[model samples]
Target: MQPLPRHWATVRETVAFPNTQEYALTIHGASDLSLEDAQRDAQERMALLIASGGPGQLHDSGLEYYPLRRLPEELLEELRSPGGELIAAISRNRYGSAVLNTDALLISDVDLVEPSPQDRAKPAGGLLSRLFGGGRQAELTPEQQDPDAFGLPGLHRRGEHHERTLHLIEDFRARHPELGVRSYRTRNGFRLLVTGTGAGPSSKRARELMGQLRSDELYMILCRVHDSYRARLTPKPWRIEVDRFEDLGTRTSADETHHAWVARYRAASEDVAVCRLLDVSGPAPSAVEQQIIDLHDRAVRPESGLRLA
Candidate 1:
């Protein structure tokens, strides 16, 4: 018997928190402006967003227009802990900002790789002057510095916490062959995907897998993808769903859906083949019977288009 594909409900909701933790809501671009002004803008915007809820609740607004130089040390400490949340530090200095999440949800353990001397030298002269004064220069140890200190741009140091989390996922996949994995790069880090079929033991088995993620040190997280498909027979009346690997949620149907016999080329000489799976249907379809047929068909001609040529 073949397992039926489950329909996952699409959520347009956000994760809820019981309390505001010690995390720093980082806001970028405010480096040019005064910290007080930046904080005021962030607070006002956050209040408004919270009041008018929708997609706003789903996204992290904690870091909007945050002031960096005047950031409090206590907040910095929270940013380093596993439970600490760093809102709105732009990853890769991209156009906008994002939350810097820790694997343990503790922010203090987060460590940024130091920038190169050229990058470090770019800091305002006043900060440089402070580094030279007050005998506080000793606190600026190499190990304690950010990755930008090493002159490597856009390099993030995955503290022990995050590394352990990733390994746990890889380890789980190794133990389970039927499972599929997908990954996507995010502003602060990467997003992981874990998917499989069946119920009973299969669904129950996810708990153990989830435990590994919770206990691991890595800050990355897992999210399930949802999809919908309309039935050709019923048209408006019937629909079905299947879970598939997706890199990011930003793809349009044209970009995500594959066409048979399409050749995608990176360069004039480089060649790559693109193929999409086609649904097989007649007057009636059986999930159990067709699954076997699909398996056999795939085995016989895995590279062929869904339709007969």
Candidate 2:
């Protein structure tokens, strides 16, 4: 039988000056570029804006950048009236980015594979497949290696690898009966409903049990998050902050232990906004049945959060 087709997942966010006007450039580079490199990219972009606009002055805070502005009349007149045309001639002969930037593409991506049922279960194709592919596959081209080689990450969203993650999670749930998970469909991607069961003398223990379950679930998910993006040459996604949360549990005023968890986890993942509960008996629930319920009185969104440690 022919082997399954390879799957790649790519996501790119247009980098901006945040509070300033947008520029003609974005920052994309090596998968492992460091702090100094990022700042250099910013400086290079500032220079580019000058070229596009011509003879300007610009500045930035260590944290943010300002769009280039034309130098004042006195300075502009001095440079132009005397040697400007000579410099312009030299610049015309130059043959690269009008800007000083070497990193023309600011996008980053994680290479992925679409594994079949057989592949998903194979120890080689499981989590490790996220990193190395089905052990000794054909080498990827240089374009396939560095997303920059292609100029852009992709024209549209690539979510088949996402389906693969869902499959991995299902396999995780099957192998580990101690935990429970459900997928929450969001506008762009999936959030997870995570819960687990454990017995304890006090609600404290129950909360701990729930925490452990969330931790384990996140470990598996994030393992994929980091490991799945296997390309070593191109940049990986800039930020990995929490996108959303599936209602994991709800809490009454009296459910202090659970409520405390809600506050702590929610604060930790302030980006998310939703909550739910699994009868306070999750992962390893005791006698209570695992009937999922809203943590609030009205039909509220699941603001509860996950700790992807």
lDDT at residue 90 of model 1 (Cα atoms) = 13
Any runs in candidate 2 off by more than 4 Å, and if so which? 1-157, 199-292, 296-309
C-alpha RMSD by candidate, in order: 21.9, 25.2
TM, every model: 0.21, 0.22
lDDT of 2 by residue, 134-165 (tens): 56543544323432222235411133344454
Please name the candidate that would achieve the greatest lDDT relative to the true structure.
Answer: 2
lDDT of 1 by residue, 1-309 (tens): 111111111112132434532322332212124556545654554444445342233345553222221221101111221333321111110111111211211111112223346645664444343444443443544422333122334222233223444455456556755644443222222233333423221233433554544422221221111011001100010011212113223212244332110111112112211112222112222233233323223322324422111
